[model samples]
Target: MIAIDINKRIGRGPGSFRLQVKTVFQFNSVTRILGPSGVGKSTLLKILAGFITPDSGLIKFGDAVWFDSQIKYSKMVQERNVGFVFQDYALFPNMTVAQHLHYGSDNADYINQLLELGELTSLKERLPRQLSGGQQQRLAILRALSTKPKLLLMDEPFAALDSALKIRIMERLKSLFEEQQTTVLMVTHQDQEWEHPKNQIFNLLSQED
Candidate 1:
């Protein structure tokens, strides 16, 4: 399990609010963050991903200390063994689908499996610019999943896909996560996205209650 008890004052002037978050993320489970916009959902994900530093507090994952403000220790992003899926589907402009999948992994068998899972087998040679919005989203997801990360952090991961396609991929994605035993923390605004009983939910605003 991972725990985060931190505070960061976001923005400035009258518009800013201190993002005070204290929560525990269970290991080998999917936790969906739920809250209104500007409630620090994505900010919380960034903190866990090591892209942002918390002004105070500590973050511990099992026996590893990811961040401890008092001690001035912060684990590097790559060393944290975490995968991040950006909301904007950060795909390479020049790389094809195959190249993206093969970026970190040379396991052709595993690459094929992810391609099939994402229904991108036929589009493997296509670049991000050539693919549709939904296809680009799938490619982004596959790139992250190909790593088989210890923990995956996603921000509105399914925003581009239609409802039917979202459900279809999510079903297989859940199975893959289970097989890999990957811990996931996702920020979602859609109610039906990964709406399963097994997943945990967190309301940021009510986190202190």
Candidate 2:
């Protein structure tokens, strides 16, 4: 189980917002954080991922204490077994798709499986700049999964794809998650995106209740 008990102040000047997440996320399930644009949804995910520190509270993932403000114990982002996929699809423009997958792991068989699962085999030689937006997004996700992380965090992963492509990718993701059993925490503003099976949806703004 991943338990996040935190309270932090965010933003600048008079337009700042306060973020408080005193909740527990179960294991091996997809938890979708739903809210408006500037409601600190991504910030909460960042804190959980150990990219941001809170003024007070503790974060425990199973037996590991990832962060504890009272004790001043905080793990680095790399130390946590997390796979993060940003909304913009952060990929090296000069590197080929094959190179990206290989960079995460040296296992050839795993790389081949990722290529097949992501439908990226055909585009292995293509660079990020050469691929379409959706293709780039697929590559980004594949790269993250290559790390074999216990927890996967995605921010608006399907925002750049069309509805048809989104549906197809979502199906593929469901299969991949089932096969790997990786815990996923995804943030999205669209309600229709969280209709997948076995997913727990939580509205961030309503979290206080």
Candidate 3:
């Protein structure tokens, strides 16, 4: 399980607010974080991923302590073994689709499986710039999963895909998640984008709240 209680100041002027969040996530479960703009939904994921440090709080995952304020201790992003799919699909422009996945893991069989799952086997040799927006995003997702991280964080991962394609990818991902036993936290503004009986919803409060 993941436990957190943290706070941070975000932005400036009318768009600013104190982002105070406290929550626990069950292990091996799927969670959807929802909120309006400026609610710090993405920021929360950043904090979890170790990109942003909280002013004061603690983050614990099972027996491991990811962050601690009193001791001034915090784990590095890479040390946390987290797989993050950024909102911008942070791909290496110079690298081919296969290279991105390969960088995440050295297992040839697992890499090949991921390529096939994303239907990217045919385009493995193509670089990010050569692929469409949807394909690039798919490569990003596949790369994130290549490591089989314990916690997978995604920010608007399916934003660039058509509804039909998104559904297909999501269905395939559901199976992948089960097979890997990975916990997921996906941020989305559109509620209809995901629907499953096992999905737990966490709605962030606006600063006004």
Candidate 4:
């Protein structure tokens, strides 16, 4: 289980608002987080991933204590076993598609599988600048999966892909994630992008601080 009871202050002065949430996310589940613009949806994911620290509260995932503000304890990002796909598709300009996956994992077979799943096997040697926006996005997702993390966090990861490719990738990812029992937390403004009965919607705007 992933339990989060945290409070953060976003921005400074008059623009700042209290960001507080207390929710227990189930294991092996896909949760899509939604809220009004500037509600700290992405920040919440970063905090969970240990990239950002909350002003106060505790964050626990399974048996791991990711954060405990009272004690000033926060786990490092690498030790959190998290795979994150950022909104900008944070790919390295110097690295090729194959190289990106290789950097995260040493298993040749798994890396090859990731390339095939992303439909990037043929373009494995191409760098980010040589690829289209959708291709770059797919590569980003594949790079994150190279580690086979227990928890995956994605922030608007499908914006570049078209409807057809998006569906295909999501379908394939669903199979792999189910097999690995991986938990996913995603931030998306579009509800139609993820239309499935199994996906739980965690609407931040609907929750009281």
Question: For candidate 2, lDDT tens digit of each residue in 60-144?
Answer: 9999999988889999988897988888888988889999988888999999988887778988999999999888988988898
State the displacement of the C-alpha of residue 111, model 2, in Å, after optimal TM-score superposition: 1.6
What are the lDDT scores of the predictions, listed in order? 0.89, 0.85, 0.89, 0.89
TM-score: the better of candidates 2 and 4: 4
Residue 201 CA displacement from its true place in model 3, Å: 0.5
**What does candidate 4's lDDT look like per residue over 1-209, in tens digits?**
99999998888887778889999988888899988888889999999888888999999998889999888999999899899999899899999999999999999999998888999999999999999999999999998888999999999888888989888898889888899899999997664646667768898863333
* Candidate 3: clashing residue pairs, number: 0
Model 4 / residue 18 / CA error / Å: 1.3
Q: Estimate the TM-score of every prediction.
A: 0.94, 0.92, 0.95, 0.95
The per-residue C-alpha lDDT of model 2 at residue 151 equals: 95
Error of 3 at 86 (Å): 0.7
TM-score of 4: 0.95
Task: State model 2's lDDT.
Answer: 0.85
How well does candidate 1 score on lDDT at residue 16?
Answer: 80
Clash-forming residue pairs, model 1: none
Clashing residue pairs in candidate 2 (N, C-alpha, C atoms within 3 angstroms): none
